[model samples]
Target chain A: MADLALGKESSDFKKGLQAGISIGIGYFPIALTFGLLAKTSGLSIYETVLMSLIVFAGASQYISLSLIAYGTGIFEIILTTFIVNIRHFLMSTSLNEKCEEDQLISKLIYSFGITDETFSVVATKEGTASTGFLFGVISVSYTSWVVFSGVGHLIGANLPQTLQDSMAVALYAMFIGLLVPSMKNNVKVIVLAVFGAIFNSIFTIGHIMAQGWSIVTATLLSAILIESAEVIKAKYRGAGHEK
Target chain B: MRSEIVWMIVGMGLVTYIPRMLPFVLFKGKELPPFIQGVLKNVPYATLGALIFPAIIFIQKDDIWYGILGAAAAFIAAFLGANVIVVVLGSIAVLALYSYLL
Candidate 1:
């Protein structure tokens, strides 16, 4: 019985690896750009690669690079990173339901691998995602993210000065790219983004706060304002139905 | 300077790990309140928006179009439902060409 179970586990692991291929491939350019950006932003190759190795969250890492460039304080950067990654809470909770019951250690091990892409893949799988399978999926995606990051840094070092200067815009382009699709799908997202941008501009231009604090404040305020509006709208709709 | 970067990365790693791990370890089968969930859901979009603006225009101080045009390319690609990689690559391609022409 043990032998049979081991065989099944191996097969499940293989399946997970196969499933992760697309995510791994998708990560190539993004991770590479992140590495390049880190270098351009004045991070040492060691620091750049270490950030990828440790943090492993894409948007937060990118944001950190920006904050670092602005000479933001360490504590502020960390707080901003927390705010950016707060959505992971929801993803992790939802994934917990989809994943199989396992030892706490096992759950802990695999949870580290959960990202937006990995969560979607695992949560959407037809059956409960086994621990081995989660490992399989994360292994591929993690390897690509870490490896390509280093590669990008190396490439950045070799690029001409002019191209390097222009590459600075790619980070913002990446953010716009990520936001546009969700904005198209949900009007609320558009409102949230616009509000966030407007508030951030006001704060930044007025010099009311440091750059890091400005972003953190803008994000929290916009989220709260937009979601409260949504809730109020929903309540009014309910009232209208009752009337 | 090096130590500061290390501490920052460590701090980031902690904050990041907490969110991804706490729910798995602590919550057996519970859901957050609807309002909290709604706020959390909007956080990413809000954060993204905040990150882009103000900063985008300042990317190339000498030539604002450098930033605007790159953002336009990314917006178009993303609007067409391209994946993250394509959107990034598309913007890069556009900016590379723009720079080359200049």
Candidate 2:
């Protein structure tokens, strides 16, 4: 029985590795960009690799590099990275319900590997993923990011300026890809986004924590508005039915 | 000189780990309310929108026209129900070319 269980676990690991590889495939350009940026920011290869391994957040890492390159204060960089990543709190909160029971170790291990791409892919899985499967996905994504980042660092300044310029589209493309799937069922999302963008723009004029706060407010406000609308609509419908 | 940078990077890593790890620990055994869950469900999309929406039109300096162009691209593509990749690539292609030219 022990041997059989061990075999199952190994296969799960293999499955996870495959999933990770798939994630890595999508991560290619972003990780490469990360490498380029880190090198340009004067991060040594070892330092760049460590950041990829530790922070493991593509957008936040890029933002951090920009901050460093601009000579932004340490406190501000840390604060900004934290604020930008605050959304993960919600992602993990939702994921907690679906994770394996009594598997705190697995949750901790896998949570570190969470990314926008990973969360989108993994959250859609049907049931509680085995600890092994979780690691499989994380390992694949993590290794791909680190390896490609290094490749970028090594190829630093050698990459064509056009290619570097073009890669800026990757993040937007990835987000839109993720958005298209959901926009179909949710009109509230459209409303929220529009209002959020308007708010963000207005705040940008004033130079507030416009980037971070605009998003947080828009999301919260739109969500609240939609839910309230639903409740009111349901009440009116009930009244009409009674009449 | 670079070693100092390495220390900063290391410090960043340590700090980032806490946020990633804390949620897993605090929410481990319990279930949250449905309202909270609903709110949480929408955050990823909300976060993505916030991050991308502003930058779409206004590249760097106060550029209102760019914002309109971006919104138009997203609106048209989304209105036509274009696939995310197509919409993304099309918008970027259009904008990048437009921005470079203008």
Candidate 3:
């Protein structure tokens, strides 16, 4: 029985890695740019690769580059990384529900590999997510991100100074690339983002908080407000449907 | 200065690491309440929006319009559900053109 189970697990891992191929491909460009930007922002090769290896969160790492460029303090960067990656807490919890039981160590190691893309693919796999499968998926995606990041830094090192400077604009465009899809899919998302941006702008203009804090505070406040409105609206919709 | 950079990365790693690992350790078999789940689902959109909007408005200090053009390209590609890499490339292509023409 154990042999059969082990064979099933190994096959699932292979399938998961196969599924993760597209995700690994997807990560390459983003991770590469992150490496390039990290170089532009004055991070050492070790620092750039290490950031991807350790933090492994895309948008937060990009945001940290901007913060570093802005000469923000270390504490603020750490705090921002925390707040930006806060969603992972939720992602892990959700995946835990779908994932089959395994060793605690397996959970510990694989949980670190959870990102938005990995979580989505695993969750939608049309079966109970096995530990072997989850490990397989994360393994490929994590490796692509770390490896491409270094490649990008190397590429960045060779680019002309002029083009390197121009690459700065790509940062904002990248964020928009990540954002607009979600906004189009949901009205509530659009409102939440707009309000958060507006609030962030006010905080920026008012000198109300440091740059990092301003983004953090605006996000928290906007999330609470928009989500409260959503919950209330959902209640009304539920009531109306009942009638 | 470089030492400070290393420490920051390590620090960021810790905070980032904890969140990803904690729930697996703590919430292994338990399901969260529906209300909490709803909030968690909404987090990315909310966070992404806030992160994108005002920052998009201020990209190039001198050439705000330049920033808008790149943003428009990103918006169109992403809204159409182009793959993420395509979305990024679309924006980069537009920006490269905009920079070259101007």
Candidate 4:
């Protein structure tokens, strides 16, 4: 019985590793760009790698670097990171249903690995996601993210001065790349993004608040306002149909 | 400066970890309220928008066009349903070519 169980677990882990290969490949350029940007943002290679190792989330880390570049306050940076990653709360809650029952410690260990990509893969798997399989997928993706980050920083260090300066544009370009797709998919995303951009521009240009605080405030305001507008619109439509 | 960065990273790690972990630890089999879920869903898009603008224009202070052109390239790539990697690399390629011509 024990041997059979062990064999099953190993195979599940192997299957997970196989599933994660594409995610690992997908992380390469993104992580590489992160490392390169971290270098340009004045982070030492050690600091860059440490951020990737500890934080592990791509968009938030990229945002942090930009915040750091702005000389934003540390507390404010933390707050912004929280706001940016709040979506994980929903993802995690939803994923818990698909994951097999496991020990609290095991869940704790694997939950740390629940990135957007990893979560999607595990959640969509045909059956319950095993603890061993979760570990397999996370291990590959996490390793790729951290290792490529270091490599990108090393490459960035050797680039010509002009190229390094041009790299600053890459970060903003990356943000646009991320936002545009979601904006295309949902008009709500379009409204949220446009509102966010307008609010942030006002706060930043007007010097009404520090850059870090501006982002946090703008994000919260846009989300709350747009969501409220959506709720009110739904209510009005419902009333109209009744009449 | 070093210590500040360290503390910042530590704080960030804690905040990031808490959201990802709390649901698994505490929310077992529960769902968030609809309004809250809607707001959370909107946060990423809003944050992304805030992150991009005003900052993009200021990225290349001496050459604002550099920033604008790079953003245009990224927008085009992303609009065409390109993945994040292609969008980034495509913008970088465009900027590199622009710089070469300049």
Candidate 5:
């Protein structure tokens, strides 16, 4: 009995480690960019470290950096990040169901480390997600992000302009890589992407909206519109089937 | 460089903690509503779309054309069943070429 229990524990540990490995691959590049950008944004090494420790969300951190670069107010930056990350509220709503009662403390701890990659991993798990497993996921990811960010910040500060230019292209490439896999599955993703681009262009290029709020507005309005259309489509399909 | 920037970063760090910490405390032992659950199910599609659509049309520094070309190349590459890395590289290649030529 004891050995059986030990076997299961070891297996779950391996599972968590595998999750961490896959997550670390995706996160390392992006977090490296975040660190590099933070340093370039006039933040010191300690400040960049602390920001990664606290914010954890790569997209928001990058956007926040740009906002700061644009001289947006502190309050506005926070507000926009809050809106951008509002999806996490939904992510957490799904996550709460997966955690165990006794493991609430660990859940809270690991929740602090929740990035999109980690959340997607945890959300898809069946049965109780072991604390060991969650931490295993968090530990590897958190360590890699922090370490790479430090490396990037230190190295990035002294790099020549040509090198910075090439390193910067990695981000858009990364975004494309992140997005293309998912877009393959669903047509609606393509539609929303289109609307999001159009909305952003009209608002940003046309000078029709405040720059600080432009992307936020585009994301929110497009999400609502896209999701609403899907709901209506589903309802119509249901009604047609009923008749 | 200034002391105020350090203070500002610290302040932003502090403010971020509220949301990160709040969800754990507020939702302990609670089940989310069904509609909310449904909405959560679709969030990936929503957020991904929201992120991608803007990428194609708007390059920073007010350069929209190159960005749009990049996005279209990405979309076509994606539709052809290319991997994400391939799609991204294709877009970058196309955009870089366009920028150089035009």
Candidate 6:
């Protein structure tokens, strides 16, 4: 009986890993670009890979390259990355309901591996998600991110100087890669991007604060403005319907 | 290793880790306020926007047009729901071409 259960668990893990294969592939270029950009930003290869190993958040890790380029302070970089990742709080909260009952330690380990992609894949499974499956999914994804990040950094560091400098453009390309998919789906995303950029530029030109802080401040203000507008619009429609 | 960089890496790790793990650990059987959920949902758009908008236009100081072209390629590729790696390589391909042509 125990042997049967173990076989079932192993199969579940293999299935979860199969599900994550696409996500792992998706992470490759993003993580690679992050590594390249980090090298361009003067990070040691160790520093570049270590960031991925530890932080393991894509956009935030990529954003840190720009922050480093800007000569932003360490504290500001951490703070900015934190704000960028704030959405994970919501993702995790929703995922809690879907996660199967397990030891607190199991939850702790796999939760650390959660990224937006893993969350979506695991959360959308047909029924309650097993802790073993969660580990299988995120472990593959996590390994891809960290390992390819190192691969990118090593490849980047070996490139000639001119090519290395040009790779800096990859950072903005990375950001656009992130932004466009969402904007295509939600018009509100377009507004947020348009205004957020305008606001951050104003702050940059005005010299109101450091660049890292400017991004953080502009993002918060834009999100708040748009979110409030949306809520108010929904309220207005509801009231109008009542009339 | 510089002390500051070490601190920064560890700090960023904590920031990302906490948000991911906190809810699973702390909210075993609870729900959060609707307002907070609403805000969190928008965080990605707001944050990605703030990172990209004005900045993408200026990523390359010498030839701004290359940056613009790169953005266009990435935007289109992602808009079509191409895999994220493909979206990135698509932009890189464009940027590389612009460099060669110009």
The residue ranges of model 6 lying beyond 4 angstroms of the native Cα positions read: A1-52, A55-107, A110-156, A160-185, A238-243, B1-16, B23-30
Q: How well is each residue in A1-243 modelled by candidate 3, as lDDT tens digits?
A: 999999998998998887676567657767888998999998988999988998898978999999999999999999988887776776676677778988999888988888767765675465589988998889888999999999999887445533543455454555555566566656777887788788888888788876556665776777778778877877878865642
**Candidate 2: residue A95 lDDT (0-100):** 63
Best by TM-score: 2
Residues A1-243, model 5: lDDT tens digits:
999977876787677777666556556666777778888787788878877776777777888889889998877887776665655654555566566564556666777777656665565455677766777777777888888777778877434433333233433444455555565666776666567567866786788875445655665566667767777777879865642
User: How high is the TM-score of chain A in each model?
Assistant: 0.67, 0.73, 0.67, 0.66, 0.63, 0.66
For each candidate in turn, the TM-score is 0.63, 0.73, 0.65, 0.62, 0.64, 0.62
Rate residue A237 of model 6 by lDDT.
88
TM-score for chain B of each model, two decimals: 0.67, 0.73, 0.73, 0.70, 0.77, 0.69
lDDT for A158 in candidate 4 is 42
- Cα lDDT tens digits for candidate 4, A103-156: 889888888787766765565466678888998989988999999999999987
Give a tens-digit lDDT track for model 1, residues A44-66.
Answer: 88998899989999989999999
- Reference-based lDDT, each prediction: 0.80, 0.67, 0.75, 0.79, 0.63, 0.74
Task: Decide which is better by DockQ, 2 or 4.
Answer: 4
Error of 1 at A125 (Å): 13
Q: Per-residue lDDT tens digits of candidate 2, residues B1-102?
A: 366666666666666667667888987434777656666555555555655566655543456675556556755675677754466566666667766787
Query: Model 5 segments beyond 4 Å from truth?
Result: A1-43, A57-87, A90-102, A115-141, A156-243, B1-10, B24-31, B56-102
Better of 3 and 6 by TM-score: 3
lDDT of 6 at B15: 95
Question: Residue by residue across B1-102, what tens digits does model 5's lDDT show?
Answer: 466655655565555555555666787644666444454444444444444445435453466665666666766776677754465456656766665566
Q: Which CAPRI category fits model 1?
A: medium
lDDT per residue as tens, model 6, B1-102: 667787899999999999889987787543557665565455555656666666667767776786677778878887788865576566766776677767
Model 2 C-alpha lDDT per residue in residues A1-243, reported as the tens digit of each score: 999988887897887676555456557777887898888888888888888877888878999999999999777887787787766665666566666674677677788887766665455455666667777878888888989898989888444544444444444544555555566677766665565556665666567764555556665665556656765777879865642
